[model samples]
Target: MRYEETAQLENPRSSVSTDMMVGTALYTLAIGVFFVVFGLRKRQRWIVFWGATMVVAGAAYVVAIALGVDK
Candidate 1:
């Protein structure tokens, strides 16, 4: 039997581009907004909470990218 090992880099380069990241962030923000609105209409507190969490995360991701945190 032969054993194979996977090597991991200390500082791996990200293949995701700025445009792709922005697009992903925007999509997440949109979904969060949808969840928040739907939850409000349905009066679901848990859903609202989760939606708000997603909103914050999406916004933070955008801010982080803008600040060059990815680098």
Candidate 2:
């Protein structure tokens, strides 16, 4: 029987890009707005909470990007 070893690959380059970060922020904001609209239309408290959470998360992402923490 032969034993084989697997090597792990790592990316030394930074994974963050200005365009990608901005796009993600915009996407998250859109999703938050959608959730808010859905919650209002459905009159669901849980949906509203989720929507608020999404907004906060999106804001945090934006801040992280601005701070260059993605690197």
Residue 11 in candidate 2 has what lDDT? 60
lDDT of 2 by residue, 1-71 (tens): 98798785786565887787788887887898889889999999888888888888888888888898978
Pairs of residues at least 3 apart in sequence or in different chains that clash in candidate 1: none
**Candidate number of the best lDDT:** 1
User: Each candidate: how many clashes?
Assistant: 0, 0
lDDT of 1 at 32: 93
**Model 2 score (lDDT):** 0.84
**Which 10 residues in a row give candidate 2 its minimum summed lDDT?**
6-15
As a whole number from 0 to 100, the lDDT of residue 4 in candidate 2 is 93
Cα-based lDDT at residue 68, candidate 1: 94
